[model samples]
Target chain A: MPEFEPKIVAFCCRYCAYTAADLAGSMRLQYSPNIRVVEMPCSGTIEHGLILNAFEKGVDGVYIAGCNLGDCHFLKGNVRAIKRVAAVKKILDEIGLGGQRLEFFHIPASEGTKFAKVANEMTERIRQLGPSPLNKNAAGNAQKEGGQTV
Target chain B: MIVAQQKPISEIAQMISDCKKVLFLGCAGCVTVCLSGGEKETDVLASAIRIKRTLENNPLEATTFTCTRQCDPEYIAGIDNLVKDVDAIVSLACGVGVQYLAERFMDKWVVPAMDTKFAGGSVVHGLWEEKCGLCGECILHRTGGICPIIRCSKSILNGPCGGSQYGKCEINKDIDCAWQLIYDRMKALGKLDKLMEIQPLKDWSKSRDGGPRKSIREDVMIDE
Candidate 1:
């Protein structure tokens, strides 16, 4: 939103957040372009590995947006997604990413403004956190932490 | 159910290194329903092992097979043809299944691919919490269905420990206070009268302390 452009990945449930993003576009609501949305059949489909892989591939922040908690198209799918995200957060915290980099939220398919807000909020949050520890300048240290040979 | 989790890929790869022909065994009982050592896990483990070996400059042949229930001999007999030519077996089952496979295929090396966790069930999908202590005895009739022996942070068989705070275990903020849950459930069912009844000291002999327990019934035995 300013001089700093933060990189982010948004995992959108095909039933909700993805449609919300499409609605946001139709409304011409301008938000950060930094977020690359990865659409899933259900947000519950996102696994712990996919989240870890995103950070490993250098994404500064990640979030999964799904149908509001009990409103999942496939009943209870959103609940599963929340549990998976919480589990991944534990691993992220253990690995010293501060655990705040991973997040999950719920929104209705019609809430276009909420989509924009979430985007702007995440982008701003990552900006304040600064370039990821995995950024080029400190990538060597991040690689060791990522358990990958850089 | 016997709870188990997948071992790290690298460590599993290391376990079956020298074997050229490997038999991948899957258990369809507890592990299949739990998604740990089921057909999917069996295939994944075999594929990962094959891929890792090829990538590490060691080409190996991998074959996969799943048993209806790996803990029983009748089900294991079905794998005779599957294990015929494989150099070794990597079992994606519980420790019981591994031993069963070893006993079944006495001549072949059967390796375990999962670390058995506990006797538990899922409170949420993909989350299996220990629900049963398998203590060879059950006392749920008196304390409501909640098993303090398994779900309680301290495994307390009585009432709430002083450490519980607001129905949460003091040992870990994430853990639910098991006795509190028991109390609430009992109260709701108009069964609080049972709490005052003292539970006797558990007979540890009924559990693993009994040393490799087994059961048999001549009436159910097969006859030729």
Candidate 2:
């Protein structure tokens, strides 16, 4: 049997987290290859339905990476994202998905090292939790696309 | 507009515990304006239910649709084919919408996902306050556009009732005295003399006390 490598989706804001991920790659930062990044104009635009849709699509875990407090390029984008993430977290727990499976990180544009650390942390956490219960064929399919970011 | 809040997901899940497929119906009228039962909320609810059922190893197939106004029979008629295969319907509209669905689709089990709260408008982005009492009468003309029936702690027509203090109601310090507002408005309009006149007893029969009421427009009715 193939090993279980959880698939994680990361919604990253272009002004901060997305750039930080890019810098992480340039800096030779070693982290788990389980993450699939979706770049957004601002994390505030992250809809609760979209995160829930990702879970329904069978992702093992999901996270939003936005700017640090008072650092959003759009003034309060990260602030808005934080409140939205909290609301979605509550909904996820209500739906029996375990709110811990979803997370939010405040990573500024220069925090390449922090971005790598978050990737490793989320990967290890999800690996211990195993694949999502929604994924019926998780054991058979998790390793099929181990390093793909789609 | 009617304001409502969505029921807890646990309660909603319990309602459909025995069903394998369901349709989530959202209303685009008052519920939509209140940010409770709209198209986006319908989709989110469907996803949540599907995820919950899948996690429990009893996968549920969910579909979503939004109507312009669920209270109207014409909009309900449009979804005849959509309800053909669903085991139950989860209505995200207010009580009226829920009843309409139940009446229109007698074979399907209809459940409400929101608790119909009150007839009011949004005070802020996410805050709603009850403004009207739905007393089956309009007395805004008499009270300077403020309502004493719903806003006052006690529905006294000639209010201030010895409970008003510092422009606030005696029930809670946070609530403004309704009669105070009426006085201020009337004073500003130079119509404070209106307050001196004694008001007669209200006709309670016009309100919900009279039982379920109906409005008919015979002139607009089509000849059969």
Candidate 3:
């Protein structure tokens, strides 16, 4: 059997983690290639529905990278992100998806090394946890056709 | 406003486990203001249920719709087409919305996603506290704008009962003694003398004791 490689999604705030990812690339840092980075205006804008959407789409793990407390460029966006992450974590646990599959971290723009480190760490954690239970069957693929809005 | 909280995701999932497709209906009225049921919430619930069902290998097809207000028949009429194909409905409004959907779609299985809590206003961004008991009467003027009926531990007509201590109810230190609040307000307004009068027994018949009540405004009625 081929070694399991976990698929992860990272939601990064433009002013912080997103820039840090760019810097990591500039520095030639090698991190796990399993991640898909999504840049957002602010981490606070990340919604519970979006995180759940990722899980429903069959991602093995998801994480939100935001600015440090009191360091948010928008003043309180990072703070709001932290609270929202906590809320979604609880919701994930309430569903069969363990909250361990989701994470939130503070990564400032200057921390390229930290960004690479977190990327590898999250990838390793997910690898050990294996694929999310939602991905156990091929049915999960068909379920991703997404919900309709009426 | 009416306050409500969503039921646990597991409970909602269990309610519709027998079905393969469902509609998550949200209300834009009180439940939306209270953050329990709204468009955003409806989407989150749909996603969560889909993920849960997928894990169980049962899979699920979930759709979402948010109406202006679920309690009114006029707003519910908008979803007639949407409900035609779904196996079940999960209403995220207060209990009223759940019953409205049930009454409208007699053949479809309908369920509540929130537990209607009380008549209250938000005290903070995310915290809500009950303010009104819905006793079918209004006595705020006589009570100096504080409602002892709902705030008091015992709903005492005239009181700080013998249990009040440090302006807090004996039942729970966290609760303010409603009569004490009324007294303070009355004193500040120089209406303390009003509390000195012996109060009359409340007419219980005007409240829930009168059974389910209704109000009709003849001027607004459209004769059929």
Candidate number achieving the greatest DockQ relative to the actual structure: 2
Candidate 2 displacement at residue B107 in angstroms: 1.3
Cα lDDT, model 2, residue B210: 97
Residues A14-97 of candidate 1 have per-residue lDDT tens digits of: 899999999999999998877888899999898775776677556778999999977899998889999989976765654456
Give the whole-model CA lDDT for all candidates, comma-separated: 0.82, 0.91, 0.89
- Per-residue error (Å), model 1, residue B135: 0.5
For every model in order, what is the iRMS?
9.1, 0.8, 1.0
Model 3 segments more than 4 A misplaced: A136-150
Per-candidate alpha-carbon RMSD to the true structure: 9.4, 1.8, 4.1
lDDT of 3 by residue, A25-138 (tens): 999998887788999999999999999988877788899999999999899999998899899999988876889899999999999999999999998898788778765432
Maximum-lDDT candidate: 2
Candidate 2 CA-lDDT value: 0.91
B94-200 in candidate 2: lDDT tens per residue? 99999999999999999999999999988898899999999998889989999999999898888887989999999899999999999999999999998888777
What's the distance in Å from true for residue B146, model 2?
0.8
DockQ for all candidate structures vs. native: 0.05, 0.86, 0.75
lDDT (Cα, tens digit) per residue for candidate 1, span B1-224:
99999787667767778889999899989998788898877865675555455545686788888899889999999889989998899998899999999998999988889999999888786788888888788888877888988888778887699988999999899998999999999999999989987767899898889898887899998899
User: How big is the positional error of residue A118 in model 2, measured in Å on the Cα after superposition?
Assistant: 1.4
Which one wins by lDDT: 2 or 3? Answer: 2
TM-score of the second chain in each model? Answer: 0.94, 0.97, 0.98
Relative to the real complex, the DockQ score for model 2 comes to 0.86
Name the weakest run of 10 consecutive residues (lDDT summed) in model 1 chain B.
B47-56
Give the CA lDDT, 0 to 100, for residue B20 in model 3.
90
